[model samples]
Target: MKATTTSAIVLAGGLGTRLRSAVPDLPKPMAPVAGRPFLAHLLDRWIDQGITHFVLSVGYRHEVIRAYFGGTYGGATLDYAVEATPQGTGGGLLLAAQHLPADAPFLLLNGDTFFDVPLSQLTELAASQQTDWCFALFRTSEPGRYMGMEIAQDSRITNLRTGMEQPERLANGGVYIVHPRSLSGLAAQPDTPLSLENDLFPRLLAAGQRWFGLECPGAFIDIGIPQDFHRAASVLPVHTAQRTEDALHH
Candidate 1:
């Protein structure tokens, strides 16, 4: 069977309280890193992989994001799903579910982290594994601060941070290719904040849902803190240059 065209849902709803001192006026996704909005870099990379549609899940200062990116960027069509209240990652995804097709797989990414894995490779890995869900895992130099994923020898994600299962060392890289049917059990609640990591994933594991992890060797940086933001900015330029050189050679 031919691979299906992919659509991306970028979870851009966080208030960004941690980086507020540095970027008080804009949403975290709109925060500047290396001269342009951090999201622009992500979009550029994904567009290179042939992603033509994007659904931005926006909440705080959403108007600013809409004003800046408008309907499209660099030929990719942009769609917005605004959340009236703060919704967790799972909630944001559920809200955007209506925009995605039920039979196709779609990409979901956190707004604050940059995972530089090749999009084509990630998509291929997801399809080849025939898994219900796939998460990109990064072997971080320091894994204490981040949420970790324990993967078995067969490359299946055994558990996330909360579980007691132990396996090879790998951390969640915050990029995912999810089959729409895998989320069929998630129901929106009134007051509870649901997280994909803490809530849905554990249940999926219990139910024997196939969740695989793909290791990302490229730079994975989180822009949530002040120092991390600085580090990302410093690293991104060099990373982009290297990618350009590689593309030229290929």
Candidate 2:
């Protein structure tokens, strides 16, 4: 059976320190790409994939995001989980995840990065493997820039490392299909920064949770730095056009 995961959580609360020069007053996800907030493009793609509800974890000038998007965009319901202070990625995710339905798998995304992995494929893999978390992965020739993942032949994720200098390895695409039960024991501690990649995921792996990786050959981009932020202005519009064409042809 095809997996039924339509709810998504976006981690949009990052401080955007690296992109501060370019987007001095906005949250990283609110940085404009192709004349619209980067989150808009992210939401558009998920909406195309049939996601009907989204919970955005917003901090660091979050009002800009809230004021612009409001309660709905492109026909999908938008909800916000505001952080009064800086909570790290994992904390923000846990905060936003509370808005999701209690019993279904949901999608997770990083607001600054865009990896167009098909949601259906990720959910299908999660169902077939009965995985607690199904990671969408992409091959990157440049290492040390993204988290490296080691996968067994059966698709089980055997290892995770912050930096892998090896070439053409699978890296986390910043997209995920997660079972709600996976977050069972994880709670955000006050004033403590929790990193999803640096802390929670490694601990979960050590505990032998069912984590699997599915490599996706999709267009990927991260608008975290100045150069890439400018590059997104060109790349994203072309990607949108291409995706629309692909849908029409299909």
lDDT of each: 0.80, 0.87
Candidate 1, residue 18: lDDT:
97
Quick one: best TM-score, which candidate? Answer: 2
lDDT of 1 by residue, 170-224 (tens): 8888898888988886765537767777777778879888899888888888899
* Candidate 2 Cα RMSD after full superposition onto the native fold (Å): 4.4
Q: Which candidate gets the maximum lDDT versus the true structure?
A: 2
What are the clashing pairs of model 2?
A: none
Q: In model 1, which residue pairs have backbone atoms overlapping below 3 Å?
A: none
